[model samples]
Target chain A: MSRIAITGIGIITPLGDTLTLNRQALQEGRSGLSSLEIFPTKYASLLPFGEIKITDKELKTRLDVTEPGVTRTTLLALHAFKQAVENCGLSASEIQLSETAFINGTTVGGMCLSDALYQDANFRETGSEYLNSYDLSSVTLYIQQRYGITGICNTFNTACSSSANAIMYGARLIQNGFVKRAIVGGADSLAKFTINGFNSLGILSSAPCRPFDNARSGLNLGEGAAFLVLEKEDNVIDKPVYAYVSGWANSNDAFHPSSLSDDGEGPYLAMQQALQVARISPKEISFINTHGTATENNDEKESIAMQRVFGNVPAFASTKSNIGHTLGAAGAVEAVFCLLNLIHDEVYASLNFDTPIEATGLVPVTEYKHMRVEHVMSNSFGFGGNCSSLIFSKGQKAQ
Target chain B: MFYIHQSSCISHQPTFTGVDLQNLQPSVNNQLPAIEPKYINIPLGQLRRMGRALRMGVGTGITLLEKHKADGILIATSNGGIEDSITFLNQIVDYNEGRLTPTHFVQSTFNAIAGLLGMITHNTGYNATHVHRGLAFENVALDVTMLLRENPGHIYLIGGVDEISVRNYRMEAMAGWYKKEPISNTELYASETEGALPGEGAAMFLVSNNAESATAKLADLKLLHTADENLVANQFAEFVRDREIDLLLSGESGDSRFKRYYTRCEQAVSENTAIARYKHFTGEFQTASALALWFSCWLLQNQTLPEHCIKRSGSKTAFNRIALYNNYQGVQHSFMLVESV
Candidate 1:
C-alpha cells in the first residue's frame, strides 16, 4: 500500500489568517471569540463568535477574486487555497493547469448570499440573476474555474465531519492510484442561519464555551477555511512536509438524525477503524484533539467513547473554545492545529475550563505545556451521526 | 467481486418490494397529486426528526437493510434538504437576522440522513455522504464497491437521494437549466427537447460480499470530470468493451444539449445488444444514476427488461453483462459495468 503525505497547508481561521499566526495564537492562549459585528444582525451584538475581522472587499482583493459580491464562503475558500497552493511550492501552472482533483467539504456554501438576496424587496427585479449561483454545486464550480482545475471537483456536506471525509477520500484516491495529488479540505462562513440554529437547540453559550467542563453551556459559531495539499509519499520526499494523514475513518450512528447515540458507538467504531488502518494501538496515541462542541450531549458522549477506547485518557482539548465551531471547516482546521502541535511539541490548553463534567470525569488540558508529542488523533462529529477521526503523525520520516 | 444483494426505490412509481419491473404511471401532467406512503407507517419515530429528504433517504435505507442487513451505510445527495435550508434562511432574513429556530439548520446538513440511518439501525460502521452534482450517487457507489473489495466481510448499504423544492425549481428556471414546457416524464425521450424536466427521488441497495441471490456482480466503475465529447465517448467504449458488456443503460434525459453523449454511446454498441433509459422515471439530479443501478439490478435478477425502458430498434436478449453510462450536463461522466454471477 502506498503512503499518504501532507506536503502543504493553508488556513484562514479566526485565530489568524496565516498558519504561523494561527499557531502563535494557539500557543499564546489568545481567544478569537468576540461579539459578532460583521453582518447587521440582532444576534450580532448578543452572540459571542469567532469571526474573521476583515471586510468583504479586503478578502476579495487579497484572494484576487473578480466577483466581490460572491458569497463569503467562496472568498474564505480562495484565501485558504491560495496559501496552500503557494506553500506546496507548486507553480501556478501545476495547480491551475494540471489533473489535480479538488475535493472540498462545505455545509453552508452560499446560504449567506441567498439570505442577502431573499431579504431585498426588489430581489425579483434586481437580484434574481444572482440566485442561481446560491446552491452548493455553484460554489465548487466557481473555485474550479478560478483554479483551472478541470479534474474531478466535488463538495462533501456531511456537516462538521464533511472535511474529514474529504481528506480521507483524497488519501484513498492517492492510495488507489486515481489522482497523483489532491487539494482537499473545507470552508464555511458565519451566517445568521447558523447562529439562530444553534440558539434554537438551546446550546448557545452567552459566555465563552467551556469544553469538557461541568459548567459548559453550548457552542459558539465561527467561520473559516483550511486546505491541505496531499500527494503520494514518493512524490513529496524533498518538500517541506507538515504532517502525514496516517489513518482516518468515518462511521454513522444510525441512532438519530440530529442527536448522537447514548453509547457513542459510532464514534468509538470510527476511532477504532482509524487506529487499525494506521496499525497503531490506543496506548501509542500521544494526544487527542477532541470534537468538543461544548454541547452537553457531544462532550459527554465523546468522552465516554474516549474512555472506552483508551482506558486512560490522553491529554486533549477542544479548539472550539478559542476559535468557535467552524462547521465543515472544523476537521481541517483542527488537523492543522494537530500538525502545529507536532511542530511545537506542546499541548495547547483548552480555554474556558472550570470544572470537569460529572458523568465522564474528563478534564481537558487547560494550560499550555511542553510535551514530546508523536501522534495526535482529531475527531469531528456532525449532525447525522456522521462521526470521523483522523490521525496525524509527527513527521514524514517518523520518530 | 462486490455483488448487489437487494435494491429498492420509493419514488412516484409503485415499485418497492417485488423484483418484477413495472411500468410507472406518469405523474408529470396529472393535476391530481401523487403522494408517497406515509413514512411514519414504515417505522416508528423515524420521520419525527427527519425533514422530507432525510425521511426519503432513511425510508429507502431501512427498507434495503431489512432485506439485506448491511454493516455500514453511504448516502449521496446533490442538494440535501434545500427546502429546510431555504426555510431557515428565510427565517433569518425575515426576523432581521435575529433569533432563529435550530431544527431546520440542524436538518439542512447533507450527511444528516446517513448519520440518522446509522443510529436507527445500530450499525456503527463506515459512513459517508457525497454531493457531486449529477455524479453524487455514482461516486458513493464506487466508494462502497471499493470498500467491499478491501474489506471482505462487511455488508454495505449505499443510497442516493435528492428533493425538489419550489425554490429549487425557480432557481433552475432562472439559470435556464430546466424546461418551461410541460411534458409527461414517460415521454421525455420521445421529443427532441434540449433540456430535462427536474424531478426528485431516492434509491437504496444492500451490497454484500456473498453472491447469494445477487442481482449482479459489479465489474468496474469510473468517473471522469471533463467536457471533451470525443474523450468521453472513447472512454465509455473502452471501459465497457474491456468489461465485456452485452447491454448498456444510458442516462438520456431527452435534453438535446446532453442527449448527444448518449447517442454517441448507442452508436458505439452493437445493434444486437439491448439499450435502456431510466431518468424519465426518476428525474435528473446528482444521484439519479442510483435509479439506473436499481433498474439494472432488477433486470439482472429477473433476467428481463421492462418494455417501458426499450429505447433502440433491438430485441432484448439473455444478456449477462451490462454497463451503465451517466453524466450531468457535460461534467461528471461515470460508467459502471455489472454481470450476473
Candidate 2:
C-alpha cells in the first residue's frame, strides 16, 4: 500500500503570508483579527474581521495580473497556489504532466466583486469585463490555462467543508491511480456578499470569538486561502514530506441546513469513520484541530461529539480563535495548522478562552505547550450539515 | 463495476416516471424551460417556499426514492440557486447591507438543495456537491465511480440540476452565451450564430454494484481539458478501442464556432456507429449533459430509439455499447461509455 504524503504547503491568512510569520504569531499567542480594513462596508468600524492587509491594487500589481475583472478571490488563490507548487519543487515540464491534477474549492469564487457584478448586470451596454470572471469555473480555468496544466481539473463548493473535501478528493485521485500527484486546497476573500449573509444569520461576534467557552457569542468571519501538494509515496522519493494523509471520511447531519443535530450524529460518524480508515484507535490521536467556529451551536455540538469519540477527550483547540473562521478555506488552513503541529512538535494556545461550556465541561488548551505529536485529526463542518474529518501522521511513521 | 439501478429526470421534454418521449421535438424558442411536475403529495407549506431548482431536484429525487433507498447523495449544479443569489446580491445593493433579510441569503448556498435532500432522505454519508460549470455532472459521476469502487454494496444517488434566472439570462446573454437574435431552437444547428439557446433541467440516477435490476452498466469514463481536434480524436479512438460502439450521443450545442468539434467527432468515428444529439431538445446549460445520460440509459434498457433524437441510424439496431461525448464552450470535454449487460 502507498501513502499519500504532503510534499508542500502554502497559505495566505490573517495571521501572516509566510510560514515563518504564522509560526511566530502562534508561538506568541497573537490574534490575526482586527477591525475591517481596506474593504468598504457599513459595519467596518462596528465589527471586527479577519481581513488580509494587502490592498487589491497591491495584489494585482504584485502578481502582475492586470485583468479588468480579476477578483481578490482569484488573486489570493493564485498567490497561495504559486507558493505551493514552487515549494513542492515541481518543474515546468513536471507541472504539465498528464498525471498531475489540480483540485480547488471555494464558496466565494469570483463573487468577491458582488457590488461590481451587481452594477455590471444592470447595464445595457456590451459585455462587462467582470462577466467572464464571475463564473465559478473561471478561477480554476484561469490557473489551468496560465500554467498549461493538462491533467484532471475540478472545483468544489461544499460550503465551509469545501477545501477539506478538495484535499480528500486529491488524495483519492492519487490512491486510485488516476494521478501521481495533485495540487489541492481552496480560497475565499472577505466580501460584503458573505459578510452580509453571515450578518443576517446573526452569527457574527462583536469581539474575538471564544471557542469551547460558555459565553461564546458567535464567530468572526475571516478571509484567506491555503494549498497543499499531495503526492504518492513512490513519486515523492526522498523529498521532504510535511506529513502523510492517514485517513479521511465525510458525512452529513441530515438534521438541519445550518445547524448540527443536538447529539452531533454527523460529526460523530465522520470522526469515527476516519479513525477506522486510519487503522488506529481513538487513543492514538494525540491532538485535534477542531471545527470550533465559536458559534454557540457548533462549539457545543463538537464538544459532545469529541466526548463520544474519545472517553477522555484528547487535547484540542480551535485555531479560529486566532485567525477567525475562513469559511471555504477553513478546512485546508486548519489542516496545514495540524501539519505544523506535527512538524514543530508543539501545540499553540487557543486565545480568548475563559470558562468551559456547562454541558460538556471541556476546556481547550489555553496555553502553548511542547509535546511529541504523532497523529492528529482535523475537523471541518459546514452549512447544509456537511461534515468531514481528516487524520495526519508524522512522515516517518509512514515508512 | 457500477450499474444504474434507477434513472429519472425532469427536462423540457415530457420525461418523468412513465412519460413516453415519442412526441419529443425541437422547439423554435430560444429558452427551453423545464416542465415542472405537479408533486401533488408534497405538503403545501414546504412546497410554497421551494425554488425552481429545488423543485426539480427534490421532486425527481423523491420520485426515485419511493422505489429505492440510496446511502450516499451527490449533486452537481453550475449556478446553484441563481435566483436566490441574484436576489441576495440585489438586496445587498438596494439596501446597502443595512436592511438585509436572511431568506434569500440562506437559500443562496450552492449546496442548499443537496442538503435538503439529505435531510429528507435521512442520508448521512458522502454528501457531495460539484460546481465546475459544464463539467459539474461529469465530476460528480467520476466521484460516484470512485466511491463505489472503494466500497461495493452501497448505493449512491447522483444527479445534476440548473435553473434559468432572469438576471442570469440577460447577463450571460450579454457575455455572449445565448442567442442575441430570436431564433427557433430547432434551427440551432443551421444558424451560423456564436451562442447557444439557454435551457435548464434536473436528472437523477441510482448507481450500485448490483446489476440485477440495472438499466445500464457504466463501462468507462474520462475527462479532458483540451481543444486540439487531433488529441480529442486520439483519446476518443483509444476510449472505444476494443469495444464495439453502436451509438454515440453528441453534446454539440448550436453555436457555430463549436459545430466543427462535433463534426470532427463524427468524422473521427467509424461510419457504422450511429450519432445522436441531445442539446437540441434540452437546450444548453452547465449540467445539460445529465439529460443525455438519462436518455442513454433509457435507450439502452428499452432498446427503443426516438425519432427526434436520432440523427443517423447505425448497422447494429440494438445499442449494446454507447458513448456520450460533450464539450462545454470548448473548454471541458468528457467521454462516458455505457454498456448493456
Candidate 3:
C-alpha cells in the first residue's frame, strides 16, 4: 500500500480567503474575530465571531450559482473544494472517474435555512424550494453532481470532530485500495440554529475566546470551510506534496453529552493511539493544535490530557483563539494550518491569552516563531464526547 | 469474509430476539408503530434525557455487544436525531423568546448514537457515522468489510438507526413522497402509489472474521448510483454470475415510479430463481435495509424461506445462497450477497 500524501490544500477562513493571506495574518498574530456583520442575530453586538467577511449573494455571484436553496454551507464548500481540486490540477476525466471519493463533514448543512424551511412547511402559500436541501447529504449531493463524481460519497456530522474523522476516513479509503484519491474536508456556516443551540448550551462568549487562559469565558462561533486533496504516494510522485496524513484515531469520553471526563481519557487515548499509529514517540510531535474550544472544561481537560501523553508538552496553540470555533470545519481548517506550519517551518501565536489554567499551568505558544516542525498533532473534540486526533508529518515516513 | 456473529433489530415486526417470519403481516396503519426494546436497562437519569432513536441505537449496540466482543463501532443514519431537531426548531420558531433547551441541541447530531455506543461499550477503538440517505447502512457495511479485511481477527459493531417524526413526514408529504389516496401497506407493491410508506427502525450487528457458530458469511456488498438501468443490470449480473443464488430479495417498495428498477433487476436473474420482497412488512426508511439484512440472516440460519416473502417461487429446495437488492427512489442502489458457511 502506498502512503497517503496530501497534495492540495484550500481554505476560506475568517482570517483570509487563500493560504497566502491566512499565513500572513497568522504570522503577524492577527485575529479574525469581531462583531458579526453578515447575519442578523440578537447577539450581533454582544458576541464576537470569526465571520467570513463576504455576503452570500457575492459568493453565489462569484461561484455562479443560479439555483435557489443553495445554503451558505454548500456555497462555502464549493469555494474551498474548487480551490483544492484546481491546486492539484486534476483533469476533468480524473474528477469524473469512479475512483475519486468525496467525503464532507458539516454541522450546519442546510439547517442554515431552517427558518425558511419552517415557513415553507408551515405556510402553504410558498412552495418548498429547500425541500431537497434540508438534509445533511444535500451539500455532498450538490458537490457530487457539480463535479460529476460517481464514487463513494458521504457526509459526516460528529460536531466538532466531524472533519477530522472525514480526513481519517479518506486516508483509510486510499490505504485500503477503495479509492485512488479523496477530496476530504468540512464546511459550516453560522445560522440561527447553531447560534441558538450554542447559546442554550451557555458556551457562546461575548468577547473573543481565550482558549487556554485562566479567565477564559467561552467560545466564539465561527463560519468557514477547508478541504485537502489526498492521493496515493505513487500517483503523486512528481506532484508537490503538502504533507503526509501520518496518524489518526477517534475515542469517546463516554462521560457526558457535552463535557469531557475530568481525567481527559478520550483525548489522551486519541493522542496516544495516533502517535502509536505514526510509529513515533510523543517527543517527536513538534507542536500540538489543541481543540481549545476556550470553554472552561475543554482547555483544562485537554491540558491534563497533553500532560499525561507528554510529560512536558510541546509548543502548543489553539487557532480557535484567532478564528473562534468553526465546529465541523475546525478539524480540517486546523489540519491545513498544521500543513502550513510544516511547509514554512514556523509556529503561529495563540491570541488573547493572559494566564494559563491553574490546574495544569500549561502555557501555549504566544508568539510567531520560525522553528523545526516535523510532525504536528491536531485535536478535535465535539459534543457527545466525540474526540479525534490527527498527526501530520512534514514528509512521508519509511514504509 | 465478514461473518455475522450477533444481530438485533427494533422494528414494527417481531424481530428483536429472532425474526418471526411465519406470522408476518402487512402493516394496517400507514405508520407502523415502533416496538420498544425491553432489553435496555440504562440508568433512569441518563435514560430520561435520551430520545427514542438515541435509546434504540444505544440499546441495539448494547445488545449486540452482549454475547460478542468488538474492536470498533460504526453507526449509520439517514436523518440523525430528527425528532430532537424538529423539536428544537419548533421551539426556535414558537418560543423564540427565551433560552432554548440544550437537550434537543445536544441530541441532534448524527453521530449521537455512535458516541453513545462508545460510551456504553467503552470499546472506543475506531468510530465513525455515515449519513447518506439510502446508502447509510451500505456505507457502514463497506467500512466494516474493509476494516475486517485489513485486520482479520478483530470484530466490529455496525448498526443503522433512523426515526421519523410528524414534521419529517409532513415535509416528505409536502414534497409529494406519499400516496394521494390512503392505502394499506399490504397493497404497497401493487398499488398505483407514487411513494413508499414511510417507516422507522434501528438494527445492529456484530460481525467478525471468525466463522465459528456464525449465522452467515457476508459474501459481498455492492452499491451503484447511475441513471442508466442497463448499467445497474450489468452490475447485478456481474455480482451474482458466478454464484448459485438460491434466493433473491428485492427492495420492491410499493412506489410505481421506481418499481421498474426492480423489474429490470429481476430480468437480469434466472427464471427459476426464487424472488422475495420485504418493504410491505418493514415500512420504508433510509436504514430499512438493515432490517432486511437481519431477516436475510434469519433465513440463512434457519435454512428456510418464508412463503409470503417469495414473489416468484422457484424450487426453494434448501437455502444456501441469498441476495438482497435495495434502492431508494431509483437512487442509492445496493446489493448484498450472503451465503451459508
Misplaced by over 4 Å in model 3 are A121-127, A396-399
Residue-level lDDT tens digits of model 2 in A13-50: 98888777888888899999899878888888888888
Each candidate: what lDDT? 0.79, 0.86, 0.85
lDDT for each residue of candidate 3 in B1-341, tens digit (9 for 90 to 100): 48997888888777776557676655645776567776555656667777778888887888878777688888989788887887887788887625887888888778888887777767657778888788889888988887898679999999899886767777777777766677776667779768888777888999988989888888888876665677778888888897788889998888887887889888777777889898877878888888888888888888776766778988768778888899876767889998888
| DockQ of each candidate, alpha-carbon based | 0.54, 0.77, 0.59
lDDT, candidate 2, at A351: 87
Q: What is the DockQ of candidate 2?
A: 0.77
Candidate rank order under DockQ = 2, 3, 1
Instruction: Return the top candidate by DockQ.
Output: 2
Error of 2 at A63 (Å): 2.0
Candidate 2, residues B231-340, lDDT tens digits: the string is 77788778877777899899988888788778777765678899888887788999998888898888887888877677788777678888888989887888899888
lDDT of 3 by residue, A204-288 (tens): 8888899899999889999899999999988886678889999998877777778889989989999999998788999999999
Question: On a 0 to 100 scale, what is the lDDT of residue A123 in model 3?
Answer: 62
Of the true interface contacts, each candidate retains a share of 0.74, 0.73, 0.50
Model 2 chain B poorest 10 in a row by lDDT: B20-29
lDDT of 1 by residue, A1-399 (tens): 667888889998888999989988989999999987686557777878989999788988887777634788888888888889888886767775435878888887776564555643224533354564566656676777676676666688888898898898888877767678889998988876677677777888888789999988888889999999998877775676667889889888667666677888878988988999898999888999999999988999999999988999899999999899999999989988999888779889899998999988988999899999889999999887888999988774423
Candidate 3 chain B lDDT trough over 10 residues, lowest sum: B24-33
Candidate 1 CAPRI level: medium
